[model samples]
Target chain A: MTGPVLTVRDRGGQRVATLSLGGLARRAGIVGAALVVDLAVLSSAPGTPWWPGIVVLTLALVAAEVPDSQAPLLTLAVAAGWWLAAVPWPAPSPGRVLLVALALLVLHATTAVAAIGPPGRVAEARVVRAAAGRAALVGTGTTGIGALALAADGRVVVPGAVGVALLAVAGLAWAATRPTRQ
Target chain B: MSGWHPTHAHLRAVVAGFGLLVAGLVLGRVDAIVLATPLLLVALAGAQSRPSVVPVLEGPQGALAVHEGEDVVWSATISGLPAGGSVAALHPGQRWLEVEPETGQVVAADDGLATTSIGLRPTRWGWRTLGAPAVTGYDAWAAWRWVADRPQPLRLTVLPSTEQPDTTAPAPHPYGLVGQERAVRLGEGTELAKVRPFEPGDRLRRIHWPTSARTGTLHVTATHADEDAHVVLLLDAVNDVGSSGGLVGERSSMDLAVRAAAVLAEHFLRRGDRVGLRVFGDWRVSFLPSSSGRHQLRRLLNVLSVVEPGTARGEDALAARQGLGAGTLAILLSPLVEPASTQQVAMLTSAGIEVIVVDTLPAELVTGDRGRSPEEQLAWRLRMLQRRLERDRMASLGIPVVTWTGPHSIDKVLRDLARRSATPRLVRR
Candidate 1:
């Protein structure tokens, strides 16, 4: 559904602008930005099955083009990525790992957006954002720890670790402020 | 009670985010994938959410009487809660509405329960019904999502605008039986009669004491003849306010006519006069005519309240009034908006009934907006002239037209009516 909103009109012919497409685009962008941060953390972590987690993250980020339920799908993808990273795989280049992280943010945003129709549930955005924000916090923490380990080994993968934490925190904040379903 | 609201845009956002997450996962961006993944899921849940709304309505006989400019309160009791959340009811109308979240009258039960009382004032009159209502809420903790369908609706009947009465004057002559009109001989009234003078057993009051004393004979005075009057109300619907082409509200000449008719009917009934009504407008739109009793008044008011935009269709013509024979004082309530309506009233006057025309039309059908060009001003003046001519024509036909140009109390018509009514005396020649 486009999400539902009540509208009122008067004799003067004034109409209220309820759920508009512009809001949808913004939500998608928010989820997209958050996914980008999350992917960075997963990339820098060591001893993680890089491919599967990278693959899921790629899906989430790319799907964020729509930015609706992509957060949930993105979360699943991130979980899968983590599981895959736990398995053994060929050593990947830093640049390639970064690309996978960015992909996750894109996928989540785009895929979730595909589900929206009309009646514009502008209120739901907040709830979804809040929930996504909490999950983002956890993901960011894991990214930070991974970055610290790399730093101790003189690897110093600050870019990936910091990006994940910041994006997660941002997503959480956006979600918390939005008016979503109770 | 409980519901979720998932916007399509939110879902679209999820889909977009999901696509981005997928790409990030394929690219080996673990942190980005994890962050984007949660957002995708959240968007999905929100997308799936449905927002539901319910509204409670109550009043005497299930109908509420809301005065003009007075707020009519609509109370909605909400239940079914999500964690860490509150409910909000929003109506996007210009009518300023006051919403009270918690009040003494509101009772709450369960995890989340709140009542929203909204107040609205009607600036004008007529019928109005509430559209679909929307209710939305979120978790207190700001997690998960919920939405429900809300179709709460209420119908409102806003009564017309009216002003309170100022210093009042008693009616000159009471028209009804209770007021003054009493009855007499061989007939249909309520007054008592008397016994005449007697040769032997006559009472003192009946003896005509002065006449007996002077003439050595007794003669008694007898009483007869005083009763209620019957009135027939005739409405000229041929010329309407809309046809006049003035300011939308002022142009509603028909509204004025109908309102006048209603007042007349009410006043006559109160005074115990038998009142019958006839409409010259398109009665097919829903017309009930010529009846008596309390029920008839209700039917008349119902017709008056139910007004729709219409034209002076040829359905009710002046010639059709030929059936009104005589003695029935025909009161024609009209705006004289059109020349045709004027001609109709003239014909009525020529026919025999003492016809009174309550002309409610303002000569200026339109006064153009400010800063108009000379050409525009000329056009407005021409329209005004046309209306003036129509009024003059009707007056020239010997019809007593009471031109009601206001800022005047609409009650003037009712007051004048009660005064003019007198007992009808039939003389057999």
Candidate 2:
């Protein structure tokens, strides 16, 4: 009656900056695995022994360091830039790997949080389900293209051609069918 | 309102997305563009999403106003929508004019839900103010946190049954308002309308004998005028109904006070008298100077419904509680639990407002566990105490106290108060 009752307001989630060290290690491992059967580059340049592995390792670490959403874009730019700028050497095969998968993954990830309902609450199951569904369908299409290119070239293409195809497909699809309803 | 809780779908999505991000870097997943694009897009979109809330008001019963004792069909409506949203009206008081959830159309019946558009039914003859409609929208389907709403404060006054009209009380001061009006105007009445029925006491000179005899019945055509008996009904919401409260709704003392106010207001209105109300609790009682007919009844009932109780000191209430115009009778209803309130009533009567206190107290409650041994003694002592206090208080003021003790007691109390009113003024003090 005398003064207004003071009730404390609730603060939501806490913000965390950047990636943790564990995340970096995980990225490094993924990149190393991708290079396991990839002997095309190594086979062409006989003199370069551990250098190719080292480069892949470095790329993987850097890519992992990039946040999930930005990771794909940055990886595309960095990987393409690195391969183009590098000194010319006889390479066994182009790296068509990881491109389509990465592109689809980015597309899928964006749709994950793109919801149309009330604000502040967590993303709804329907949105998540739709996003996940789309991601699966997209991931299959994108990665399948790269795999096809890989088989055809007998080596993973550098600056992944599969990624280019996936990007074109996703972009076309997105532009063609922008949802009319919110 | 209905809301969703965090489910496995959410966790799974997070897992798959994060797994790819980590896998992309470690395995150098598809070209860098493939994995990185989706992650970045998702993150950006998620970040861009804003959270908001919609407010809604719901009520019991259909959108139309309802009276007490009637069946209630309550419903709720939501407002302040979130995107791609869904709402479920929960609880028994959910009355929707229509129920079409797929199209996102759910109407609620109630009032005061500010965030939501209000839908209500006047369930009783008092103001029906509803709490905010329960509505919580989420950014996505996930109901991360629910926001409790402040009531969309609404007021729907339910006027009591036809007001009886308080034509009985005489209004001397506050010029324009005097006594209850009739068709044939009286020299002492307020307004002059018409003359129809003739009584035995008709002045011989004033009679229209030819018209009366021709009509076969002794008749005097009367006129209609604006007149009223100014009576103030003071409500005491701080009452106790009984151990279990009252009627299935657990109405409590406050309910009695409200109903009493409604009935009294109706009575005063019907008699074509000016009536006002004075509520005691959370909000100050209302005052409408004496007026006549059905309109005044509507106004009084409306005020009764919205009259909130306040914490004004007993004495402060005492001053404003009785809106008197010299001869206005103050019909007060209180439980008289506290001495402060009773003292104030005594003071009002002393100041000349004809005070009549209706003790709307709760019935005494004691289960089998409560010993019956001292019942007689306790009753005797309580009665003695009440009498002593009441007698002492009335001795100094021209007022009477009526106790609504049990079933079938209202009529008796009304008669008692009426008789007391007829007593000589000096003798009353």
Q: List, residue by residue over B362-421, the lDDT tens digit for candidate 2.
A: 444211122356986576457547745765666455456655543233444445545565
Candidate 2 has a TM-score of 0.43
Residue B288 C-alpha lDDT in model 2: 60
| Worst ten in a row by lDDT for model 2 chain B | B96-105
- What candidate 1 gets wrong by more than 4 Å, as runs, is A1-13, A16-182, B1-78, B84-110, B114-130, B134-251, B262-276, B285-297, B309-312, B316-330, B347-354, B362-390, B393-398, B405-429
Supply candidate 2's per-residue lDDT for B379.
67
DockQ of each: 0.07, 0.06
lDDT of 1 by residue, B1-429 (tens): 543444433543454445546554455544444334445555544433322333222211234545335676666665655433444444433332222211111122234565545555555444565544554444332223343455446665654333323413223232334322343332333344653555455345555667667777677544444544445666666655433221124446665666566666665555555566666655443234454567766666555544443543665455436545444456676766555666666666565555667776644444432125988667656756786676666557544567644323334543453354344533221
lDDT of 1 at B392: 69
Score chain A of model 1 by TM-score against the reference chain A: 0.30
- Candidates' C-alpha lDDT: 0.47, 0.44
Instruction: Report the number of the highest-TM-score candidate.
Output: 1
**Model 1 residue A14 lDDT score:** 44
Worst ten-residue run, lDDT, model 2 chain A?
A1-10
What candidate 2 gets wrong by more than 4 Å, as runs, is A1-182, B1-227, B236-255, B278-310, B314-327, B340-356, B364-429
